[model samples]
Target chain A: MTMKIVFQKTSGLTDKPTHYCPGCTHGVIHRLVAEVLEEMGVLEDTVGVASVGCSVLSYEYFNCDMTQAAHGRAPAVATGVKRVLPDRMVFTYQGDGDLASIGISEVIHAAARGENITVIFVNNAIYGMTGGQMAPTSLIGQKTATTPYGRDVSVHGSPIKVCEMISVLDGAAYIERVSTHDVPHIQKAKKAIRRAFETQKRGGGFSMVEILSTCPTNWGLDPAESLEWVRDNMVPVYPLGVYKNKATGNL
Target chain B: MGKVLMKGNEVIAESAVHAGCKYFFGYPITPQSELVAYMARRLPEVGGLFLQAESEVAAINMVYGAASAGVRVMTSSSSPGFSLKQEGISYLAGAQLPAVIVNIARGGPGLGNIQPAQSDYFQVTKGGGHGDYHTPVLAPASLQEIVDLTKDAFDIADRYRTPVILLGDGMLGQMMEPVEFTEGTEIRKFAKPWATTGTLGDGPPRTITSLELDAESLEKRNWDLQQKFAVMKANEIRYETYLTEDADYIMVAFGTVARITMNAVNKAREAGVKVGLIRPISLWPFPEKPFLETRDRVKGYISVEMSAGQMVEDVRLVVEGHAQVDFFGRTGGIVPTQDEIFEKIMMAAGGVTV
Candidate 1:
């Protein structure tokens, strides 16, 4: 007979309920991280690096030790923590805007330097906390508060595919792009997170998991439609799969 | 854990290691380049992480990544480099990340000069970064303070979860002084239960972020930061005064300039000029209380700085029409001689040549 396992409380999140909007994938992503930590049993030794963007108050959500970093700087901060506490697991959670614009320099170096840390990057395409500003991952011809018309490539540039870029870095041990729009995708994402964490545990170089997430409110779409939009639009530009894996050739 | 003579820049890098800082991200900038070189050599020995980032921006971010992992980390830069770091510094402050930043200040307002300058007075004290936040700044007048304050900076940084700056000038970075390393003080191996060292134990993963959407909530966080700053000011304020009693004019300076001003004070006193000096050791809370209390007694004040009239404005604000305040400075890679300072003092003292 199968015994029921009650959901465990996450150490890094706060006791307070989250403030995420309905159908928002942030809550799901948070749950995935918690479940992964529960499975890994390193919650006590885990220190999370926070980033700027919609999830800035993510410190309140995790029960474990959490340190909030500047935008795109979560990787840098994680490097610091992991360096000092070499035995402890360090990871940073950042959104697209935070990772792409202001924190680009930090992200590139951390990956290039092969910092023994994990990066849980949430790419929701639009800037949710900043009121629908066009993000670096915003689709071409996408409308945002900042982009009254469609995003112009001549003026604004195209969406950045981080996983692809990071895969090119020789130092990056593992680079993967996954989504959370469906159950299969969620499972894949969990596996990706596990591999990233495992790589760090093995003293592997930098590992990154780019989650193609939803910002239904910001995207002005229903939850289902937003997930579909991600599947349709984001996946083409940012493909889902392990772009680079040092351990295995293919799945 | 032994005594040794070292420069201010060298001590800062050494102290970070002693405090269990295992990661250092920096790029070579003038005056503070020694700090980067020292870390590059030593960090590997201790199994620490060291990398020379491409730019000051990258360096600051690397520091950011390392600090987020709940490790003690640091970065050092000069004036122009500090300007590039302001954005990252603001983020660190806003997020309540504990890290150390050493600013070996040089002349500025552009690619100003490579010589020592206290030009970053407003930048360091007033939170040059874009934010309603304050970084607890410790100004080391001597090399000893560099060692002591660097360790103290890590303590205060971790305790308060804020960034702390060890503000020195190019002169202090270059000048050698004797320092006693704390013998047998066990290296602090702090346990950050929330760092992302792979989620172990029966709990959920944590996230560290600085974003708070609700204006009211963000405002409250800002308020909390202000409260912390207030506490730091009350507890962390430090300074030193030399011969302020019965003096007609008091010279205010810090770092190397303060050291120079002291020589000027002694020379002027020998010549019957009746001058004193107020050397600020902690530049952030700015030793304002003592200066204000002594404001009524002194007839005039002179600000000795390497920049053009930065600290003088602060003195003027505090003096508040109580005394005549004047500024004497050498701009852009120039260090004024003791004779020039003495002349400035005599001129400030009714042109009575000493």
Candidate 2:
């Protein structure tokens, strides 16, 4: 019997190792994004904007040209890049703290303007880079560093549903929320990533994929348990589904 | 081409187009909204981009992105809006990106007013953001001067791989003057090998970032920036002198105040008082040579300004006890008349209270 290769790394990813914490789902999301770009034949003509969270160093892992934006400014930067080079595909990779807390205006305005770009939003419900603080996406009862005794909805407010908020904008061509917990869900997340980039390639307008990710270290759970935690706690609030798909009229 | 009467703000916008600026991102603000409007109408015609950004902060970061992609980009705002752009300006400096920023200044400590004032001299020249960096600031005294400087700003920014500011007051932005765009303008092209444009099989991908986790590396980056500023200070000092050959008193001013002080100098000369004017064209490099050269010949200097007392500190530092330096100005959107500045010059000359 002849041995054959079952899998290989995509050319869209650099050879360098990632700095993500062990058992964090960020690596899986990164691989999925790289695979999507590579499969779409846009890896060479793509520009990536990296945000200011744990993924701040994402520029090193993405094979395409990358520009690192200041905290909460990636969408504005992506708008700039896309406007300057409309033929080139542009996307922003941001965490919940970057996209939901501080960068809300930039993202909203970029979508409102119908900027033809893509966004990969990783919602892990915690600020991972600066320690495990309560992110804007943190669940109402979730315990974080800042919320040592579980988040109080009355005090801290409910988790932001970014997909729902962005979907209401007329300019948003596609919006979806997917998870990266299980193999089946991982496949679905990759499909959403592909659709987001396809929308940009076809000049469909602003497309975003909010991935429900896992932060085992920050969640104080082991790698396997974190996935279960995401399924049990995050899925109910986030609700995995496509919020808006302009091509399919699935709003 | 004959001269055409143009508003200062519009001329700045047209000049950026003539200088090959392909992207413009800005928000609306007083005294400078005409600039944004002009770009909106003109950029699209020339196959360029003009985006009315969500805010000044977003506009500046957008400029950062376009500039990193190896294109000439610009943004304009008034005082308060300019204050919001400082963080992005610092990041541009840290990333060594070339960009042009225009500030049509208004009165300010907070939302002071939307009238011409030069209160932002220190905030601009001293690096308004949190970093060990400096932006080369150019102060234009008239509509034509602003047009010329706005064109040259792109070149200066690219040559130094740093941000260049065209600092004008509200009068400069709001007033109309005869400007001939075809004369004395040189079009030069620059190569941007460091831009973050996709490699496209030409080379490895480029990464434009300001973040450095290691302390030693960050310090080294800061030192490199300081060295670039030192070179700029050495080679880019610009100013104008009027009748300073045989004077006992000199008047120092810039921007719109410089033009007013020039009239004041002529009036003082008619009264048999030997007074001259030193108008600094570049505020950061600050034309210190003029003050150093005239220190011994002049008995005293009167610093005229639209602010309380901003540029006077720089004049005092350059004079360094060689002569007495007195400050005279108005504040809160108030502009001193030519007669008011003349009286201050006479007061400084005679050592009498005015």
Candidate 3:
């Protein structure tokens, strides 16, 4: 009997091993992005901007042309790349600390300018690279290194719902919040990533996919429990749905 | 081509466009606002990109992005705005991306005023960003020189694969002069096989990054950068000497201050006082050779500036105690008049005539 190969590495990804922690879900997100680029036949024409975070080394993982940006400046850099080479597809991979905390202005302004680029935002609700400090997206009752007593709303305020905030911008043509807590949600997240790229390929203005990810190491949970944690805690605050899709109707 | 009188800032912008810089990102700051406005109107006509970034920090990062894509890009700002861009500049230097930056310096220890000042001489020439790196800084004294330097800056940046700064002051930015746009100036293009514009199956995908987690690798990168800077120092020192031969006193100046010092030199010569001037065209690989060679002959050196004696430090370093180096400056946007500079030179020369 002849063995038919059902799974093989996509050309969009490089041969180097990833540095992501086990059950971190960042690996899954990376694979999804690479697969989408390969399937869309834009792997050779894509330019990826890696933000300063756990994914700071993402430039090595992506097979397409990549540039590493300073902490929180990925969107601005992506804006430059997209504007200069409008025909080339550009995207930024940013984590919660990078996209929501220090890089808020860059992300907002890039979207507001209607820059034709895609953004893949990974929100794991904590700063993963910097040893689990309190992140802007840390849950209200979640315990973190800085928020050892669990996040208190009176002290730390609330988590920023990025998809909702960005969807309201006039320049953002597509904005979706997806999760990778379950196999079904992972499939849905891949679909959202594809749609975001589709928006860019079709000349639609700023598109973003905010994927609710898990940080098992930082969250002090085992691999399996971390996915459940994301499903039970993160999904309620950041609802899994398309906040704005110009092609379809606004939610 | 016929010469047309244009504002210095406008000329710099137009010259950059002529040099094939199709992407410009900047913010509005006085003394350099005209450059941004000119780019806004002109870039579209040439099918280029002109984006007015929200801040200078964003603007420089945009330049970084465009440069990484293997294209000519630039940004312009005044002192405070330039300070905000230091972080991005450091990244660009670390990544070895080629780009041009223009600083129409205004007065500042902190937003001092909106007038011309050379206070930023140390910050720019000595690496304004947080790193052990040097950006090749070119100082232009006239509108024509500004245009020429702006064009040359792009080429030099590409040649070295490093950021080059065109450092001017408010006077240089706001003043008007007749600039002849010379056609067919030799434009040199460098091979950017390292740029992140997709490899197109030619090779592995390129990565432009400055982060090296390993201490040994990072140290090696720094050493390599220093070697490149040393090469620039050897090949790129530029200065103009006026009546330096058979003179007792030499005034070291640059940019607008150099123009004023020239007037002072002529006045001192009229009074039978032997005075010459050394105008440093490139401030980074500062014209140390001129100072060293003339140190023995000149009685004393007067460092003319529009700040609180910044460039004098570099002069002193080069002079190395061969002669006394005195500083004459008018700080906080106060430009020294011709008479004032001449008087300083007269005092430095011990009230003696040749």
Candidate 4:
């Protein structure tokens, strides 16, 4: 006999070709998030908040209920919704520029308060949606439109280590960083996403999963080379591991 | 019908909850802080939610969130803090979300003073935040009227699908007045099925958003909002007229200043100065009809306020240069006395032709 699989039909995501460039990691990440909600049977109860950067169209891709939040304020909006309806599953899908820049205070406070919510932070190291601007995570001496020669530490300051900072907060019950370069890593990333959602549903505190993603178009790299860069250069700066996990259920 | 002694701010807060408001989000601001403190304790007792947000901006957004969730929500602030809440108010109006905001008017161009003033009349009645929008503003002159109008604000807000502002001054917030409570009134549970609240197996989830990028569609949304506002003006315009029949002069005022003008009117009547008053209960719709009707019968009008002549402009527009209009006010935390207003009214009546 052959095994069977069924995908969630109620998701707000459409079947149209995504706006992302070919081999970009956003599509895979979107599917992983939708699949987690589908697998958990909370697709109807989920409310996804889209960010200001590249994922601004995220509301169009997620099949569940969705809202668009201002740059860096997704966590605050999600906090409002979750506080009003404690039983509903809520999450914010944000990019590096949004999570680490203008919205840093909201993210840190929500995490420090141990808010029962999930944060799907996509770390592409560079601003993807806004035409490859240098991001907070833009590596030192890393070349981009804004950092033409390289990201100079003195003027720009060092890259923000969000997951590490959140991991130490007593309110954060689960924190992890994962990658999406290969099948095994993709599988591990899915597990991390599912864990964060589960911890939120179990009435535990804050949970975050940082996915080290590739932006080939913005990175000025070929499809294969972008994946290679994420594996080599990015991995060294942001390692893949379960930084902290107190509610590691089956996944 | 009779007065019951109560701290002005606490009365307004308790009256809202008693009127069936189940959610409040506010950050502590002076003068109006008691309103938040009372709601913090009282709302939870009624199974309502009260959150003291990180900042006034966050508090107003939280009210936006709850209002979008289809619950009756409210927030309060003084001048400096209310300025921060303008962004959320604009969003609420754009989204057509119903909520209540209390502006206990204080002196300011910037935290100038904590004392009372009617300076925010223009800010409240004339699209305070931005974009082409108007919020229904209720001006309450007494503690009893505060409770009564606070209840009416929710109904008007939801009916119009716009934010409603109860424009009071620091004096109204701090004074004590007698209040009466109503017997058990059943609340009308209006649910926003579009909300993310667990829908109990409902069909699809609802989303509350103010964003509509499509130019034509957004224009249509704006047009629809204008139509709703038109209806509100037609039906919800409220005001009180005293001794206008066969009077030579009329005083136009509102909020705390209106109360003082009332006293001046009674004094002017005693001294044989045929003076009357038109108190605007709904400041945004503005009761233009009442003022327009008095044009044929009355002499020149006198506008008394706490600011340096803001609402006077609206009065002039309605009067349409038909009568001579002049303004008398004290700015930056100074309260104009009833005696001073009486003297102005007497002088404007006929150069004290005594």
The 10-residue segment of model 1 chain B with minimum total lDDT is B194-203
Which of the two, 2 or 4, has more DockQ?
2
Q: How far off is residue B67 in model 3, in Å? A: 0.4
How big is the positional error of residue A187 in model 1, measured in Å on the Cα after superposition? 3.3
Please tell me the interface RMSD, in Å, for model 1: 4.0
lDDT of 3 by residue, B105-169 (tens): 99998877899999999999999999899999999999988777888799889999999999999
DockQ list for all candidates:
0.43, 0.84, 0.84, 0.43
- All models, RMSD in angstroms: 3.7, 1.5, 1.5, 3.0
Minimum summed lDDT over a 10-residue window in model 4 chain A is located at A7-16
lDDT of each: 0.83, 0.92, 0.93, 0.85
Residues B168-266, candidate 2, lDDT per residue (tens digit)? 999999999998877556678788888877777678888999998899999999898889988999998889999988989888999999899999899
Per-residue lDDT of A108-144 in model 4, one digit per residue for the tens?
Answer: 8888888899999999999987789899998998998
Return the candidate ranking by DockQ, descending: 3, 2, 4, 1
Chain A TM-score compared with the true chain A, each model in order: 0.94, 0.98, 0.98, 0.94
* Count of residue pairs whose backbone atoms collide, per candidate: 52, 0, 0, 11
Off by over 4 Å in 2: A1-3, B183-186, B352-354
How much of the true A–B contact set does each candidate keep?
0.70, 0.78, 0.83, 0.26
lDDT of prediction 1: 0.83
Score every model by TM-score.
Answer: 0.87, 0.98, 0.98, 0.92
**lDDT at A1, model 1:** 100
Q: Which 10 consecutive residues of model 2 chain A have the lowest summed lDDT?
A: A77-86
